[model samples]
Target: MIRCSAQTLVALFILTNITATICCPQTCSCQSTPNVNVDCDHRSLTAIPPGVQAQTAKLDLSYNKITTLLPEAFNSLSQLKYLHLKNNAISVISSGAFHGLTSLEKLYLNYNDVITLPENVFSSLTRLKYLYLNDNAISMISSKAFTGLSNLYELTISYNEITSLPASVFHNLQNLHRLEMYKNKISSLPVTIFQTLDKLYALDLGGNNLTTFPFGIFNGLNNLNVLMLMRNKISSVPIEALRSLPSLQHLHMFNNLLTNVSALKDLQNLKTLKLDGNCIQVLQDGVFERLTKLRILYLQRCCIETVFPSTFRGLSSLLNLYLNNNELKTLPATLFDDVQNLKRLYLRHNELTSLPSNIFTGLPLEDLELDHNKLRHPPVILSLNELHYLSLSHNDLEIIPTTFPIQRLRFGS
Candidate 1:
């Protein structure tokens, strides 16, 4: 009995070696040093390679010519945790194509020619955590397309041709945290489209053709932090559109058609606000009175010619301010009185003729640009003790002012 047991042990070792040799396909290279990783990327194959080892964990099939994903195409790869099929011509995915990949946690299907997704195509991948469908030509998605992916956290479908989505498309994605649908043709969204995404933190809808923001569309997103609405056609923002977001930190609404910013008075938790490239002509008083936590503010290229004295009264914690490329002829004396923490201030490319003597007193500015203006003398009359860089080029200054603090200055152009 002892001799028979030794022979059986030797036979089992031989069989294991044989299986490893035949498991790796001829068209791909497989490695077992760091737990079976396959590198089949850039292979111009038309179909999924056969004989992939069942123990393989990571598979890269990007930049391939594969056009179709038949049913159970990856059934042999039951242990696959990451699959890459990006930059492929894959236009069709039959139902149950990924039927056996229950452990798949990340799937990359970006930059494909896929135009539509059938229902139940990814129902078997229940453990998928990150799914990238960006840069695809997808225009239609079935309501049940993402039915079983309960553990998904990030879903990016940006840079597509999708014009609209079903109201119930994201109803089951309870754990989703980040949803990016930017650079699409989405003009309008249903009122209840984002009602179920309560845990979402960042939502980007920039570079779309949206004309108006549906009122109360963002009522339930209390935990949202970043909201990007740049490059849209939104002409006005109703007061109720952003009153519910208490946790919002960054709000980007640049490149729109906004003529007034009175709708942003309630977002007290805001840190950065971008309102550049709009049609705003004047800064109204108390428009930003409640934003005490504001740090960075951008209002460039808004065609402004006048600013009220109390426009920036409550921005005590402000650090960076941009007011370049405007039609301003003069500024109020106390326009920046409350912004004592300002470090970088851009007031270039304007039509200013003179500046107040005590305009920059008791402030710690690092970089100040006043170029391309109609100033006949140095703009800063008060001593900037911590000033390091200053630009006075392209101005009408006949001679440098004697009060200009150039002792500790680093650069002047």
Candidate 2:
């Protein structure tokens, strides 16, 4: 009798629903000022709290004691865009735990105890964009774990105990941009493991136990930009495998067992090359001839005793050269000739007893570090106009040259 028309009654029902949705849960603190955000983190919670608003966009439940994710645990949060479950003791996750979270864009399960990812564990999150599972104990992952995450952009699973990966584990993530799995126990990879990841931009596989790469290991990654394979046991590399990465810019292979680097001559777009902590005893001429766009080169701690004069022939744009901590007793006079744009040179902790007078000629050198060497005499530093700071510290110099400008020089131990 109170409602005169059906339209008025429906409008009253909608108003009542809206009022119920904005109400905050009793246990968790909610904010409706900006978007609906719920903060349930660090509550020592053993389970998901009840009465969380259905309109909440962000829900933080990290640092809790929840051990397992039951199925349909978050079924009521259909509007959740970000769910933070990091730093939890979650070791088991039901396959349908996220069945109703269709709108979830980012999921943080890092720093948890998840040991394995069962099949269809995340198939319901079709619109997920970012997934962070780093610092977990995940060692086994089903090939279909990420079956429907087509829109995923970045996936970080670093610092885990994974020893191997299925070849088709990432076959569905066509739009994935970055894949970071560093600090794992992976020793070898399937040859076609990354054949379908054409849109991938950065791949970080450093800090692993990889001994060497199979031929055509990086076949279809033409768009790859940053490749970090440092801290492995790779003694040698197949040149054909490196030749496929035409778009690679940064290559970090430091702290490995590589004694020869003739495989890096074809990286024309390379800008940064880090090869420190190896055993390459000598540098042949034109070794880096094709890397004309290289800016930074790290050859320190390589046990290098001899460097050919034309070793840096094509490095005209080189800015920083680090040859410190080596066994070099001397250097070629024209070693720094091709690197005209060179700014910083590091030759510390070497066996250099003397230097050629014209070694620093026509260089825009700014900072020169020759510390911790056996040099008995200083190099010609009078003609270097751009020289600002020169460190001759910890050397065996019997007499400091009077004609050389000592204003910017540091000669004491």
Candidate 3:
């Protein structure tokens, strides 16, 4: 070994530092110019870089071990639009951490260990639109937690340990469109939970512990479109719970314990109905007689063993029908005679082995699935004039007429 020169040793040290600084931290990215993105993740940073100023448009600080914010860390980010801090070990975000980020739009803080945040933590994010706080340990949120998010469009707080919500949690969010609070331990919804949200479209409250229904929860939701009530223990609803919603389009009540549906026939604007995975083995003769605009119907994986023709006659505009993965062995030949606009039909994984020759008479079926059944050949429909897609996989098929698909197979066998 020979002694190295001073200049040579210094140059070697500089190269080593450059290699260690190749990947940036997740909490903040510092680029030579704000036009480009800088990734500063997994660096275990304690504070945001001091040089941060209103230049970066997108700053990703996700998946870090940051526990505190210096407040001044975001004083320079006036143009920041997207800020992602998901999968981080951060437990605290200073109330002023977003003080200067007025132009911020989307904020992601999922997969963090945050238990709670200051009520006004987001008070300065006036232009913020979307907020994601799923997969976190947040137990309770202050009423003003969303104080300054006036223009927010979507707010997802799913998969958290939240037990309750403040009535004013969405107090001033007038333009709010979609709100998802599923997969939480929430036991109740504030009577005025959505009172001020006039433009709200979709609201998801699945996978909760609510036993009784939330009455008048949607009293003033004039623009409500979709309401999901799946995977809950709810057994019944208030008489006018859903009838009050006129703009409602899609209503999902699957996997609940609702045995009687006398309250559903009044949903005239309802387009799609998913009532699968429930104890609803019997549908009152005219249970769906009023859902005339229904386009898609899914009753799969439920306790329904038989259906009356009148049960589906209400869905005259239905296009797709899924009744597979059930215990039904057969359906009457006239079961679907009323659905003139039907196109796609899935009846696979059933106990059916055959169908009458006129089983699919005069139907506009383009996609028909009868696979995984005890069948040997295709349904004996004389012709599928508008048929295009057919799935018959994994069946006990043994023979097919040579005249079938006179031309070579084009899509599937």
Candidate 4:
């Protein structure tokens, strides 16, 4: 009986040892959804804790004071698929820091102090599809830093101090779709910088120091949809610069130094065009003759003083037009004749004193903004049967016309 009792105790001791090894770490909370998920976020821990199970699939370690990511920091979490390390003070990431995480698909390292990316820092993350390094101080990225991210679709490096990029930096990212590098100090790019990004759709390079549009820079981006170049120092946009972007729909070139826009006859698929805050003084006829698909046009604060009679000849699909904050003193009576689908017009902050009685005849206009102009009388809006919202405040109105269509108005503020 004593021998049998001793054997039973030994068996129990072995089982207890196995249980302790697979237990959750002391600083983290673990939940099992068939696969383990560990939450150690905001724990004030200085480093990754031990005793984490090997089957952990998701780990949250954000909002911490972790200073460095050692090579062996995540050596055991091989099954980790989603790792959140954002909002950390991480400044140094040792080589092979993510050595065994082969199944990692999404990684969040934004809002950190990482200044430089070592070559092959992400060599183990072959399946990584989404990587967020935005809101960091990353000034330099090695040409081979993204060596193993073959399937990456979205990469965001916005709000950084990166001044330039190697021409071959994005050569391997062929499957990348969206690239965000706005709010940086990038002044120029190699003409072949984006030669390999064939599947890219959206590119945002706003709020940079780019002074000129590099010709043929978008050569291989045949599927690009949205291109935002706002808040740059660009003075001219050559037609060759945008000739390859046939799939582009929304083009935002606002807040630049462009004096005039060349013919946009190639962008037949454009829907929204924003050229506000420029030095555009005149609108040449047929400048937008081919943009029949354009719906909304923003020309506010463009310093426009003269608009030709056929300035809006081919914009039959235009719904909203904004010409506020210009120096226009008069508009041609037939300026908006072809815009039969126009619903709203904004002509505020100009020096207009009068409008032709038939300026808006036979239209379905809904909203009209003529405020802050030098108008002495309300322009004839009797033909606008669908007019509901009108703003005539801050003008030089003297007498309120008794026959005005004020009954159909909903709000006039």
Candidate 5:
């Protein structure tokens, strides 16, 4: 009888403990989603959980092994904002993958092996801000891939095998900010490729087989700041190609077959200029006459033998000057005449043997790089009191002058 009483007590204790273990899926570690935010990212579950219909704002399901999403995957999630499924095995969505999500802000599906976006996949996401579909096997984006995403800001569709983008792909994304369509088989951009995106800040058209510069294109984009036109067969940029951008800051036109630079003189707000790897042996005398606000200039690996003395006279705000790895033996006497703000001057890997008299006449320079040159003596500057970093080690100099040790400069090879 005592043994039976002890067994009943043990049974009661075990049953009480089992009943105390509550099953809360939302807070349960074994069954909870990746992030427990009101907007959550759920991954690796056999199916979408049930309670996400009321919550979940930003769901990032990238790099998972899910094959299918239920038709009600996001059926009633009213607060959902961003949905990212870039690198997943999601093979199919049952038409209403995002049926009731009206507040979705961004959608990223790049780098997926998906073959197509269902016809009405994004018909309800009205406020999407950014859409990234780069590096995907998506053969085509339904003209409706962005059906109801009226306030979309940026879209990147690069590095894909897309032969052509639908003409009206960006029709309703009127407030779009940036678009990248580089490294695809797109031979020609549709005439209206950038029709609705007036607020775009940067546009890249590099790494294509374009033979002619697309003129009459920037008439719509009046606020573009950075434009990249590298690695194309473009001989020269038309003067009118950029006559509309009054606020352009940086212009990248490298690796093109060009001998003239007059077209770039109209950009008054230009800051950084890169013209390396081109056939520009002699720059226009007033090439940078209008670029007074220029700061960083890179002209490495060009056919420049000697920079014209008056070439950089107007660049008062120029700071970094890179003339390395080029075919140059001497710098013009007036190279540093008016550059009062010159800081980093790079003349490395050139065939220079002697420093010009008054080479650095204008301003406060900190970093001077003259490595890999055949120099036997230090650069003769009238005043290098502000110099900080100096590189002249890999040359024939066995010793430097005691006076060469400026207060802030560091000597190097």
Candidate 6:
């Protein structure tokens, strides 16, 4: 009788199991050294190739002509952690299409033709952290679409046609940190839409059609740091909506219709503020008195014609100030007295015909842009020891100062 050795028998059993579970489809490529990964992307196929290796941890099916995702299509890939399906024509998805992908952490569904998200479509992915759904034609999203994504961290739904969102759409995402919904057609939002997202840090709502906001809409987001509302139609900022955001550092509201910013008196910790491309014609005194830590301020192209002497009183830490493309005819001698730490100052394309000789005094300015203005004579910069680059081009100047030492200077007419 022929007797088999124990080692030979164990090897045979392992080979049998491997043969049953490790079969890469003919249209795809697989690797197993650094963990099983399947690449079936960019194929002209219309459906998912069957019999992918069960040990596959990452699968790429992006840039394909796949149109639909049937139920249980990826049930065999239980160990998958990353799935790339962006840039596909997938418009129809069965209810249980992503039913068994429990280990998936990152799912890319951007640049597709998906229009609606049925409820519980991603309920099985409890461990998902990153979800990308940008650049799609999505206009409707079920309120419970993200029901089981409790561990989700970052979500991107930008560049879509979504006009509105259900109030409880993000109620289950308690651990979410960053939520980007920019470049959409959203007109308004619920007052308490973000009440449950206490851990959120960055909220981007730029490039929308929002005309106003409800008061106290941001009360629960205590840990929020960055808020972007640029490129909207808002004419005023409500003080009550921003009173609760104590940790906010950057506020962007450029390219709007704002005429007043008196609501910014309480944001003491603000670092960067962009309010250009608006219609603010005057800067009142004590308007920004509370912004002691502000570093950069952009007020260009605002049709500004007047600025009080105390308009920049509390901005002691300001480094860069942009006042270009306005209608200012003259500036107060002490206009920059409070911003002694300023390094770069832009006052180009204004209506200033003359400047205060002591305007550039006591400043360590590195770059000063005064081009495209109506200045008849350059400002006295003999006290500016650290002046590096000075631009006085396209102005009405017939005589340029030669006493001050500058590395690069532009004084052409």
Ranking by lDDT, best first?
2, 6, 4, 1, 3, 5
**lDDT: the better of candidates 2 and 3:** 2
- Candidate 1 local distance difference test against the native: 0.87
Better of 1 and 5 by lDDT: 1
What is candidate 5's lDDT per residue for 1-413, written digit by digit as tens? Answer: 00100111224445452221212235112222432233224445444544443455565566666667677677777777777777766657667777877777788777766666655577777777888877876657777677777787887877777666677777777787888877676666666767777888988877666655567667687788888877766777788878878778887777877776778888888898888777777754557878899998888877777677778868888999888887677777776787888888988888888877687865688888899988888886548777878888688776677876655567775
Candidate 5 stretches with Cα past 4 Å from truth are: 1-51, 67-72, 91-96, 115-121, 231-233, 255-259, 406-408
lDDT of each: 0.87, 0.90, 0.77, 0.88, 0.72, 0.89
Q: Write the per-residue lDDT of candidate 6 for residues 1-413, one digit (tens) a residue.
A: 11111211225446452222345778887776567788889888788887676678999999999889999889988899999999999998788898779899999999999898889999999999999999988899999999999999999999999999999999999999999999999999999889999999999999999998999789889999999999999998888889999899999999999999999889999999999999999999878989999999999999999999889999999999999999999999989989999999999999999998898799878788999998888789878776777888888987866765544454433
User: 1-413 in candidate 2: lDDT tens per residue?
Assistant: 01111111224546442222355556577776567888889889998887776778999999999999999999988999999999999999987999889899999999999999988899999999999999999999888888999999999999999999998999899999999999999999999888988999999999999999999878889899999999989899998889899899999999999989999999999999999998999899999999999999999999999899999999998999999999999899998889999999999999999999999999998889999999999888787889888888888989976687877655434
Residues 342-385 of candidate 4: C-alpha lDDT, one tens digit per residue: 99999999999988889999778999999989999998988788
lDDT of 6 at 99: 74
TM-score of each: 0.93, 0.94, 0.83, 0.92, 0.83, 0.93
Q: Which residue pairs does candidate 2 place in steric collision?
A: none
Query: Please, what are the lDDT tens digits per residue for candidate 3 over residues 1-413?
Result: 11111211224546542222222333444553425354556767655544443456777777676666657468777888888888777678776888888888999988888889668888889999999988888897998899888999999999989889889889889889999989998877878888888899999999998766577888899999999989888778776888778998898888888766778788898898888777666655667878889898888777667777566766788898888787676677778777889998988788777776787888988888887888777776446777776667777778887667735223444
lDDT over C-alpha atoms for residue 12 of model 1: 54
Which segments of model 3 are wrong by more than 4 Å? 1-38, 353-357, 374-378, 388-413
Give the clashing residue pairs of candidate 4, or none: none
Which segments of candidate 4 are over 4 A away from where they belong? 1-22
Candidate 1's residue-wise lDDT over 66-174, tens digit each?
A: 9999988999788899999999999998888999998999999999999997777788999999999999998998888889988989999999999988887888888
Please give the lDDT score at residue 20 for candidate 1. Answer: 29
Alpha-carbon shift of residue 62 in model 5 (angstroms): 2.3
Residue 364 lDDT in candidate 3: 86
Worst 10 residues of 2 by lDDT: 1-10
